[model samples]
Target: MRSLSLLLFTFLCTCVPAQTIAQTVDTLMEYTAPSATITAYGNEPGIGTAAPVALLQQEELTRYDKSSLLSGLNRVPGVRFEERATASYRIAIRGASLRAPFGVRNTQVYWNGIPFGEPGGDVPLSFLDAVNTDRVQIIKGPSGGFYGPGTAGTLLMNTESIHQEGLFKLAPRYANASITTGSYGFLRADATIQRTKEAGTYNQFRIGYQRTDGYRDHSGMDRLTLQYTSTFRGQKSGAKTALHALYTKLDYELPGGLNPEQYADNPRQARPGSADKNASIHYHNLLLGLTDERSLGSWKLESALYTTGFYFDHPFNFDYKREANLGAGGRFALRRLLRDDLALALGVESRLQYRNGQNFTNPDGTRPGDLNFSDEIFSRQGLAFGQLTYTPGAWDFHLGLSSSQLDYSVDRTFSAEGVTGETEFTANRPVSVRLAAGRTFDFGYLYLSRTDGFSPPTLDEFRTNEGGLNVDLDPEIGTNYEVGFSTSVAGKFFPSISVFHFALDEAITSFSDDRGTQLFRNAGKTRQQGIELAASWRAISTTDKAIGLSFYTSYTYYNFTYLELERGGTDFSGQDIPGAVPHTLNVEVGIDLRNGLRLDLFHNYTDAIPLNDANDVFADSFHLLRAKLSYPFKSFNVFVAGANLLDQRMSFGNDLNPQFGRRYFQPAPGRNWQVGMSWTAAPKR
Candidate 1:
């Protein structure tokens, strides 16, 4: 706690005063952020299998008022969220979280050019506030070769840019503030300011405070966040540079899981031992980065350097831990237009991460004590990839190749007198290829692709060394083939559909033992196949009320199962892979009137999921209904929002496979509501 405060004080002292904006700046490769153009691909677009991408901007993002990040991500296809409590989030892309009961694994997240993941391959969302984001992008599929290994996919979060449109001389400087209160005793307050003093330069700052007394016992959460962004551009060279820094303090209580009987008895009650033990986590996260973009005679160059670290103290039922995570990385890319019909892109990236931590002994209902072990973990990754695209008339052909090397090591510096510790080291080099062909016409386009993926076990999966390191586990490797097409009718209706099949070797599986220790094992073989569809129609439109009567929806069918497996004297072959949901659907209806009023409605449904490898236990199917309304005034905005309007009894967090049903169900919140107002000011030139 002291360390976090000291760091916070030091950072606040270094903030430079900002001025007013002079011009508008543009962002590339971000499809829906203020502009959606076919050429938005820019240079950094996805390189393989044309991973389905989704982007949310403006109202689609701000309506939730940062209450729950999942509320926004749920609108995207092939995405799911496991929420154990407010701000404690686990995001799954195509069932990538099958092995993780909590936290984000097998997926990578980035914000303002900095990675949210640690050296151990785990990314926790507790340190982030949704209000700090301006746009969100998701890439669905294993992009291991291009984005460090993760079988699931990638999430890209972008901050509000100081150089965006609507911030020119007319609005050279501005400040905004908002306060909100909601059901379950949720409260939030925030302030933001932006300025630009010189041409092609600007600065932005934001700070927020939020607290929530959860719907269940012992599930309260609170957070504080501060962020700063600046941009500097060279007038003569036309070089653009951006800098970002962020710090956040967060701590949340853990109302442990419940067994089936306990769940039916009382869904809002905390586990007996959890309340007395004060099970919770206190975390402090810090991030910094610098990015540059420039243009050569016939080529463009882009680069970024970033550093991130976090300090956390966790006290749980079976163990206690204090962790210091540090990581650094850089990326460089060059793209050239060799000819009118040809384009080429080459990029290289490298990352290094290290974690120093200590583990202690904790009794069933007491605080941590007795330093039992001290360990250090190290991870390094490097990738080089290239892509070529040819365009002639309505036909486009693309090919890409990437090679990556990932290394991991864990060393136990000290251990209790009676316990022996073991050190482990390993490495994997994976190569991937992407091939796709597409054709576009006035009405639509068609595309097909093939790609490969690879992801290794995370640090949590290795911590159960039982004295030494768990060395029997291998990485999950797979190949995917897919085909898709999209079309539009009369410029008012749009639809897209895709189908994919992926086969894996040495798939990772999760399990917990009687001693309360989590473990990971390799399943012999597995396969995942799914179909996804998305569509939008504009029933009413005019110059002033464009897309006023618009409706959009997305649906998915996932059949992920084990092809063969034998572990712990159990033959679990041919069973539906536990934790991987089989079906999901989302629907939304948005209406905008010329009178400056907006109303949006949404619905989501999820099919039952297997809770065990034997496929005997299950979590029933569930659906959610949500709505939001907003009205704009001359200087401020008024809004109201509600989630899970049906107030159904369901559980979003599931204990993948438990030994004695200790904590297999963590209930979801019932219906909730919030109302807020926003005010903005910007003096004209």
Candidate 2:
């Protein structure tokens, strides 16, 4: 069967027409549209919007190695993506990662306009394949006034199945397939099929699979995913409907955090007792979504509904646990043009989640020995938002207001004491407000904005691994002030800069107990300020009819400190925040030879990071270099890439405020390389 499949793929690659390949490549290379008004948030261009918005188009996404999304995301200033190990991911916008021990927190994420964040405040970013994504938009700072209550920021992600008007629209049917293999026993394969008709109907289906023998012991991973999307436009009603469905099965081993001695002796070795304990995670998830849009005279309405279910099985040195989670949510919005220069919008969003969890004593980590605890958890969140926009001449004005509430309960059906009743907690409802104004001049655009919002504790934070709840945790309230400017030099060099200051009361942070159980608490207050700069230059364009060259760079500088905090008889006031880097710089260069050959190079530099609250321990700064080269002929394209070319030993993610002095580092992979080929078939227009 394997031989037959390989033969079929070879035939498809060799039998396709050559004339259409250039057209397909050109269509995929188009990059300027996503940064335009099509971006979320008021459907306005970046210069016209008062917020600090960063956009990554498909062309930028494809410029790096396709194994992970971290490379592309880190290119944006004030944003960070951490890879603790293969298939393990953590995302932070600005300095929000302080509250996230694992996974994604504080930030709100949307996939294809559907809220990807669950009621528990976790976004499953590891389940997504970066190569399958078409675009990304990050709105920095508190965006609760329009995107719901979030103190970190907001993220909007659109996958390839959404159809960005180039591939599917050019033909009735299109197909593409690719396979990749790399170091550390890495392998990946994927295929996509799309169909579109002139009657305004479209459908797309995609499947992907990946596996890897990770760099460290007990860090292997395997994943398989399936996705489908469909769209239809009513001919008479003048309405549009879209459906999206996705399923994923993922399994990964956990090597655990290593102390300094263990890391220096053997960087590739798993933590002590980890291998004997069978530390690993098994995950399965399914998500479905539906969206509809219609026009009523002078008003427009948009609505979306989504549901998700997931099963998680984890084994660790401390215990073995299993959980099943279910969630559902909906969003609705109405937009109207009150006048030619004025607009009004109103929206509502809500989410609900339920979980059944069980924990047991792990004699060998794989099997449960004794029932430790079992609990049922429920959470709900809701928000109502409104916005008004007025544009006169070359000036733009925006006012946004929102109110949000959250509640959760824990029912300990079976515990050490057995049959514990439920305990509920209701968070303080807050009213969020945002005001902004922008002006467009002949040479550039300038804007100033202020926002106020709050973030509450997540379900995981409230319920600790010790099978108990923490009821004293409170929400973190913050205010942000920002100023930004963007301009173009000679229609080729694009540059943008933003500076902001954020003050928070009762900031949330994490700590671990002596038993290795993670917990959360509110710090007194924090003051964070930062500067971000991004620029792009098209040195040579295809329109010039010669070799095309482009360069892009982003830089970030942060001065984050604790304004007031007291822990364990120590005053930590005026200390730098742990887990937040002070400086970062990223640069990339893309070269396209008109003759079907391409080259891309990327460089990243991160400053030393504080690892503990005392500010005595710090992770060393590091530099990384990567490059990729590809060539296309007829209908097939082949590529080769390398990562971490410097072979530097660095801790990409740190376990902050560890109870044990030395157990604070999660070393990243050393050096790696990959090669792959893809075949695409598109109809002639």
Best by TM-score: 2
lDDT of 2 by residue, 433-502 (tens): 8899999999999999999868888888888777868788998899999999999999999999999999
Q: Output the lDDT of residue 354, model 1.
A: 87
TM for candidate 2 is 0.94
lDDT of 1 by residue, 1-685 (tens): 4345334433532342323222211111111335432122243332222446677774566655466577678777788877866666888787645667667888877776555676446787667777678777777776635665667877777776544455453556766666678998888766677788677688988877788889889999888888888999999999999998888889888887788888889989987777777778888888888988899888898788899888978887677878898889887878898887788988887878888888887665355688878888888777787878887777777777787766677777888865545466564655677677777767677777777777777777766623346677787888888888888898888898888898998888777776445677888788889998888898886455554788989998999888998877999888898877798898889888876688989988988888888888888888888888988665567889898899988877677777765567888888989998875555455
**lDDT for 255 (candidate 2):** 88
Q: Which prediction has the highest lDDT against the true structure?
A: 2
Instruction: Report how far off residue 619 is in candidate 1 (Å).
Output: 1.3
- Model 2 regions lying over 4 Å from their true place: 1-35, 44-47, 160-170, 683-685
Candidate 2, pairs of clashing residues:
none
**lDDT of each prediction vs. the true structure?**
0.74, 0.82
Candidate 2, position 157, lDDT: 86
Model 2: which ten-residue window has the lowest total lDDT? 30-39
What's the CA RMSD of model 2 in angstroms?
2.8
As a whole number from 0 to 100, the lDDT of residue 209 in candidate 2 is 72
